[model samples]
Target chain A: MPDERSADEHLLAERLIQALNLEHLAVGELSPTAALFGHESGGLGLDSIDALEIALMVQKHYGVTLRSEDPDTIAALTSLRSLSAYVLAQRKQ
Target chain B: MPDRAHVINLCAGRLAFMLGFVAAGLRGQTTLLPHSLAARQLEAIRAAYPDCHVLDDSCKSDLQWQDSPRNASLDVDEQATAAILFTSGSTGVPQPHPCTWGSLAALGRLDAQRLTGSRQMNLVVTVPSQHMYGLQTSVLLQLFGDCSVHDGKPFFPADVAAALRAVPAPRALITTPHHLRSCLDAGVALPPLDMVLSATAPLAAELAEKAELLWQTTLLEIYGSTEAGTIGTRRTTSGEPWQLLPGARLDCTADGAVYHASHLPAPLALTDVLDPVSSGSFRLVGRAADQVKIAGKRASLAELNRLLLQVPGVIDGVVFVPENGSRTAALVVAPHLAAAQIVGELAQSMDPAFLPRPVVLLERLPRNELGKLTHTALQEAIR
Candidate 1:
């Protein structure tokens, strides 16, 4: 199930990068667990500003709203896998 | 509270930030404004001020407020240390710049008169409160002037619009050139606004004009630095030169220029060399240190950056001179345009010798809270 979730997140992240017009990065370059935000950029090299657009894209595609002030936002937006799991759980609710 | 608190951490929402700012002053604590609330950054501030308390949303709840104005009068000493702001270090290390309550107040008075005008506005700030521009324009303006502020540091165009809608008219939007560009790209419907204020970096006049047309409001760009604070402003649509703020004067020296303002206790020398257009107006020549003698043709990294951003398909970009070599290189965020395409277009307008070699196409620049790229970040990116 975890492996399946990982694959799902990887695909979602790839879709996200593409949707955001992040042409500098490719799907293959980033790992499923790569850090999406912060100074220690795992691979994709995103930031606080990038988070806003990504959140909007997430909502548009997945019908999930990610708020910055939410305590779970940091954990959820940590990586593609985390984001995917968070979105999956959020949508179910 | 002791006789004075050397350092006080300020991390909270907009209203808390405002309340904490006033509370700290009353308590004689110099608010330590960190550029970001990152662990390492906060650790550094904590290391500097060991007694620092984390004043986040959780702690803000502990603070008590009165519904009615207090009968007891609290005297505010104008000369007291208000905050010690750290620069984004585009030039070098994030150096501390201490500002007095008087200094901020003086700038606020001018901002209220010039930027806000006669209208009583409700400011919807897109920039973070920790940022100097955000601290002064969005938060301090509301405090000093007859205006109110919305608490959220709204991002995305929709959030920005919603934030604007939350506030009553005549409303003002305080943001950066980068944020404004993003808003324009989103093309989200914004509520009617009285004015728009921009700072942090040089705003292209074309974008400024487009913003005015889209929002149907005046767009004003503020020109200042961490060292000098807000010193000049201009209406970008008219393509007018930046006029010095009231009680501000620039005296050009052989090196750069000396910055003198009534708010500042003493005259401070600025790193940027200015070309005085008139008595109180000047054009930015470039930073004295940003000049590079490439191929015996002098050019400014700032000007090259301006040209890089102007390129079609280029979303965001920066041109920086490598410390190891005389040649220049650019790390551009233009995913649509290839490195060769950017170079080819740049060659048409700029000298061939000054064109960035091996222009690095980046997903995004490592801009700080103020939307500025530090020299260290640029070096790391190139590496």
Candidate 2:
């Protein structure tokens, strides 16, 4: 089951990278487990503004709404894999 | 207000923020509003203002008077220091500017006149209430204007649409050019709006026109900074020349032009070069400082350029703001490094949003006899 979700998360990460206009970052470089928001380095280096941007992108691309005030928002936006899982779950609902 | 209430912290929803603001002021505390909720920034602020207390949605504060222990009256001491908003300092640290309740309330009255002359307005702000612009338009306006503010801070277009829908008519939206662009780009169906207020960055005329057409509402742009509250405004359809708010005068002095508005405590020194028209309108010629704001986060071109030079580069470099844009561009003299390499190195230290895009490698930077790159020289260098 983890293997099946991993492939979809990778594709979702690529799409998000494009949506974010993070051209300086290579798609392969952004790993599934890389920290999204709080980490200073070793990831895509996203900020609060970028979080809104990614949330907007998710809403547009996957029809999944991510609210900043949601208690689970930080966990959902933790990484590419977490965001993908959250989107997948929301879409299923 | 406690004896150590000289410093305070504000981070909450619109209503809570309002209550906290009033409560803190009653106790004679100057609220510290951190633009970024990052732990590091908050920690640094806490260090400076050790007595600071955090306020958020989960705050168990009782808005009702019965449960409240403080007997302080609701009357706002107009002259009391209301808030200290932190801006991205020129030296890469956060700079705090204290704004008085009187100043904010005065600007609110001016904004109410410009936005809704006689009729009341219900505001749904997309920007966080903690921001200076948000604090003024959404929170402070309610102090003087006959306005009811929605409590939610929605960022997404759908959420924004829903927020507007939940609120009453004659509703206005306070948002940034970045959020407005995202809403437009998302193509979400927005509810009918009375008007839209934009600031933080320059709004493109094309996008403004599209938004107005889509919502059939007037779109107004505000030109202001943290130091100075809302000063000037213009409809996007109109070309240039921002009309100074009513009773707000701009006068040229030996030091520079000073801004004296009815709501300000005293005359404020203007840093931007302005050409005042006889009709009380003004055209912005240039800014004295190389400060640029993107997505409401302000950064200095000098600081960014300094960081660019520090990037293990082989040689000289310069960062210049693109014309009529918030994104910055860099011209580096490093021959061995690729654009990606330069950007990657910058990402390590600088914010990804502020990183210079289109990092152009130049043989040399054009400098005059004074070794300062003039505007014409930069234009030629980037070319």
Q: Estimate how well candidate 1 is docked, as a DockQ score.
A: 0.18
Residue B233 lDDT (model 1): 89
lDDT of 2 by residue, B1-383 (tens): 34565544454577777777776777777888886776556777888888767766654365534433223345668888888888765333667888888877778778878767746788999887778788877776777677778988887676787888889898898898878877887777777898899987767899999999998999999888887877788998778689899888889767777888887778889877878875468887777677767667778787888888888854999888766444677778998887778887886667556876556677888889999888888776665
- Choose the strongest candidate by DockQ: 2
Q: Once superposed on the true structure, which residue ranges of model 2 sit more than 4 Å away at CA?
A: A1-7, A59-74, A88-93, B1-3, B65-73, B253-256, B287-289, B322-326, B331-353, B357-383
What C-alpha lDDT values do all the predictions have?
0.72, 0.75
Q: Name the candidate that leads on lDDT.
A: 2
RMSD of each: 10.3, 4.1
Error of 1 at B344 (Å): 31
Candidate 1 Cα outliers beyond 4 Å, as residue runs: A1-12, A15-26, A39-45, A53-76, A82-93, B1-4, B67-74, B88-93, B287-383
Instruction: Identify the leading candidate in terms of TM-score.
Output: 2
Candidate 1 residue lDDT tens string, B1-383: 34447545555468777666767787878888876554555666677778665566555676655531123243578988888886433222245779898888787777787787735788888876777788886666776666678878886666788889898888889988767876787666898888999887667888899999999999999887666768788998877678988767889878678888887889988777788898788888775676654422345677777888889999998888865543577889887787756766775566444667658888988898899889899888877
Model 2 scores a C-alpha lDDT of 0.75
